[model samples]
Target: MALITLTSDIGQQDFLVSAVKGQLLQINPSFNIIDVTHQLSPFNYPQSAYVSRNAIKNFPDFTFHIVMVNLFERKPQQLLLAFHKNQYILCADNGLLTMILEEKPEMVIGLKLDSNAIKNTLYCAQIFGKTIKDISEGKSLLTIGEPDVPIIEKNHLRALLGDNWMEGQIIFIDNFENVIVNITRDDFEQQRRGRSFRIVFKRDEVIDKISESYADVSEGEKLALFNSAGYLEIAINKGNAAGLFGLQGYLEQTQNAYLQNRLFYQTVKVFFE
Candidate 1:
């Protein structure tokens, strides 16, 4: 029983997800299909990479993790199949593989599309489904397709520093409306260097210290903590922090500059004092 997982930006409102799943089942009825998520925001690769990276690690090794977000970033050229960290990942070659993995994979192959397959608008479903099927059927990874082609690179958001200040962008906003920043605990501490710091976001919301948990603050108060994923997160004790503070995620090539000005998405700033 081969396990396959799916994450996509295609909202659940349509039948595309079902059609894609059908393709998988048609190829192999014994496959165990798992839906990681289908509600990813459209073309938001950062969110896809963030969510998939955190969740996929928990799945059993050798499971196939397929990311179907932003498939049309360019044209539907080809699907990328890579074995990374003991698991297999199938996604578009449209720069997402670079965003999802920190380093190049031990194995990567491009599953080229046959002429008949490219005519369908949902070509991703066709190509990726077949690739997963072949692998599950004991197909040698090397025989799957060509290897070592140039994969597009995405510039991930990094915490910027200015002397005593570190400016970081929000990378994700969860269902609880907690804001996840690009700054990691290691990044924050390295920049802190023993100085006391104040994390400020929005207009005047300030958090002086990192908390162990959201419960560290009184209800309705804001708190900052290194989340289980090791990224700094801003959350209200029992409120919607993102909605209340009007903060959202921004990353490379995502939108306009992520800064404190009104023209762009707001960034979290830590001022060491």
Candidate 2:
């Protein structure tokens, strides 16, 4: 059976998610479809890339990831099929492929879309499904897709650094309302340089040390830790940190000054001392 994972921005409130899954199953009943997530915020590329990148790395090699986020960001000309680090990713050509992979894939192909086909989520799912089926049945990737195609490139979001401080954006807020920042462990350590640091967020809240786990702190006390995905996470033991702190996830909004101030408040700043 082929292992296929689905990630999308479509919420679970409607039938579209299930309909897309049905379309995939219709193409290959033997496919083992896994849902990474469907509740990702729309057009939030940083959050999508973070979740997709972390989840894709955990799956076994050869796993097919079908990303249905931002499918109609532009007129659909082609879908991207990328083979990176022994895994396959199918996503819209909206620069998400590069963001998730953080680099060029080992190999990439452009799966052309039919101009006449109703360019909906289900149709795109069908196109991806058939391509996976063909590859599973010994079809050469190059034969079915246009190789060496130029794809849209978008850089991964990174922390903004100063001489003594680095600022990170809140990328995700989980079910428990713990906030995940974009700063990775590697980034944190390299910047720390063995100095004591303080993580400041929401203008006034602060965490001075990185804890091993949420349990390291008293219940309802805020703590900072490197999450399983190796990103910086701020949580309160058995409490809702995001809600309590009023920490909102980062959004790339630049239009309104009010939203810009809100975005600034959402950032977590680490000062090395």
Best by lDDT: 2
Model 1: runs farther than 4 Å from truth? 119-121, 251-260, 263-265
| Overall lDDT per candidate, in order of appearance | 0.82, 0.93
Q: In TM-score terms, which candidate is top?
A: 2
Candidate 2 collision pairs = none
**Candidate 1's error at 29, in angstroms?**
1.2
> What is the Å distance of residue 224 in model 1 from its true position?
0.6
Candidate 2 wrongly placed segments (more than 4 Å): none
RMSD of each: 2.2, 1.0
lDDT of 1 by residue, 1-273 (tens): 789998988888988889888887887888798998999888777777788888788899899998888887786666789898889998888877767776677788988887665535366676777787888789998898888666776755577898899998787898899999888899999999999999988867889999999889999988999999899999999899989988877745544454435423458899998
Clash number for model 2? Answer: 0
